[model samples]
Target: MDNYLTKTSETERPEFKIPDFIENMGPEQIHERMMASLPEDIDKMPGGFPFDYTMPTAAIASELVHYHLVRGLMAAFPEYAWGDWLDLHAKQAHLSRKPANKAAGSLTFIGKPGTVIPKGSMFCTAATAAGSSIDFLTDEEVVIEEEGRATAAITAFEAGKKGNVSQGTIVLAVRPISGLTSVTNLEAVTGGAEEETDDALYRRIQMEHSMQSFSYIGNDNDYIRWAKEVPGVGDCIVMPAWNGPGTVKLVLVDQNGEPANEKIIQDVYSHIVSEEDRSKRLLPTACSQLTVTAAAGLSISYICTGLIYDKDTTTLEQAAAEFERAVQQVYSEARESGTLIYNKVRSLITDLPGIVDFETFLINGEEKNIVLSKEEYPVTETVSFR
Candidate 1:
């Protein structure tokens, strides 16, 4: 097997390149080769019967080579394989793609005191412009407090990111409780994530293969892998013995590269250490303690002066929004790098559709790159243009 974990140089690594033989195989080339191999007396002209008959054969042969040879090669490597082929690699590595997770949060119910809200009570968000709403179901029974309000834990009716609703969005009850007055979420409901993608599964498989030689007795890489096994976890930093010997601390972020919320933090902890059962934990038996927390969000503000754009084609607000999106794209991809390049951000802004040029561009009120610590991830706080 190719050692993908090894680097040829400090900054360079090997990548798979298609061989010339495979690259040059096409229907036209195959057909010409077939004609040349035949006797000269045979009719191989474009309008001849021999040409027409051989052309179809060549096309079919080319397709077989592409499917059986080209696709087979791709399926053999975790880096290039996708779909079911990727799953096969994952199985060999003892890894499985994380499935989509349902959003979970508390819902506040207001009504007459002592009103019983039954388990499986349903609530929904307001219908969107398309006349659709996400539904949530109560996880257990609860009663209204003396203050005519109570909070109940709830889970989304469906599994996926669509269940992640903002605060105050769940306003309607599917069936009105006799004494219930209103319902809403006090905090943003989060932790919902889509099914893991091919790229994510590939990374885990690569990590699995790379760490095969390393001891899995609660090492930094082991903790990183354990945290990532949770569905909503994106990436994490593991600090072994940060507090003291036999103690490990983990800082995590969600799939969007944002600081994880409490739900995700709890999920990772449960997966790694399992507070209720020490024996159920993934950690080494000798590891004394583990602590899991969310990464601190470091907000980076942008200030641009003398902004120029095509006013006739788009407004300043539109251009700024586009630039903000571009910044987010770069930030998401660079989260693991631990530094945000100032020039790269400026270049993205300059390359926007209506943007012409900016006399000054600053990140977090400076012209220098923003460096983050292991427990920090950058978030776009604000964008201002003059």
Candidate 2:
């Protein structure tokens, strides 16, 4: 993955600098040039007729020049392009930005036996002190069994990561259902992702150009491209011939870079292979077998001592949370390196908000780097600070 998509400190190219010639076309410069062009005898002084007449013309000319300059930049580079312009570039590459996806999961309802939970029944997460809840609607109707429990498929009313709630957080039903007593999720809701960012889309567009030649064959790049076409897929590790000849395996992660959930895995598989009809697959039949699986998550724990923090600005607990976030970010960026450098992790932690310094830091009780297999990606687990 790192080979194909090198993670850089900056996601976008640098801002385009206007040429000196264009810079000289500003209103003031244009006005001065026009004044100079008039005859020496002409009354071109400030507030005079010639001055007032040329000022507006110069201003309009400068505005036109600025507009055309921006249009030219948009036409010349993807970095300057946005919205519709960016879409045009993607279309030319036969790619489109992945749209946001609603989180889907099963909600278990407890109620009177044989009670019907109708489709479109609404549920929501318990509101926090911030005072808002994420709503979900039932995808299908289900009746409570003799055990007084029933599970129904549900989707978030709105798309995006805000809908990915923790287990047991969804405790409220929007409207009263007489027979439905209570509802909650047994597992964490997953697979919710925001629409692909401009940076992310640009990266994919760049990758598309690099892999165009290998697209015809069932190469690793082709498999990767096909898998990423599915919404919610962030990155993929392609292992060709992992099972033997004509076999390909793709280990995937979601948009947040955590291990892909079952739903995402199945979506990628259906997109590339189309199990119902192999002929409909994007890859050729020459790739006799294909397997799509979620990347295994390797929990990363941290232990630190002699932590230094400013209590005026943040508590130890807040600093620890910041450290955890920094660790996760580093892990996500370096996951493709197949090894998490000990120093890199320690550096990020020491730079956390409210953190001044740390006397000691150990990753999983080791001073050495953590190495992972091809199928594994690092996930933040626990942080112990003293």
- Screening candidate 2 with a backbone cut-off below 3 angstroms (N, C-alpha, C), the clashing residue pairs are none
Model 1 per-residue lDDT tens digits across residues 143-178 = 999999999989899988888888999999998889
Q: Among all windows of ten consecutive residues in candidate 2, which has the lowest summed lDDT?
A: 1-10
Pairs of residues at least 3 apart in sequence or in different chains that clash in candidate 1 = none
What TM-score do all the candidates reach, one by one?
0.81, 0.81
Whole-model lDDT for model 1 versus the true structure?
Answer: 0.81
Weakest lDDT window of 10 consecutive positions for candidate 1: 4-13
lDDT of 2 by residue, 25-87 (tens): 889999999999999999988999999999999989988777765566655666656667777
Q: What is the lDDT of residue 152 in candidate 1?
A: 90
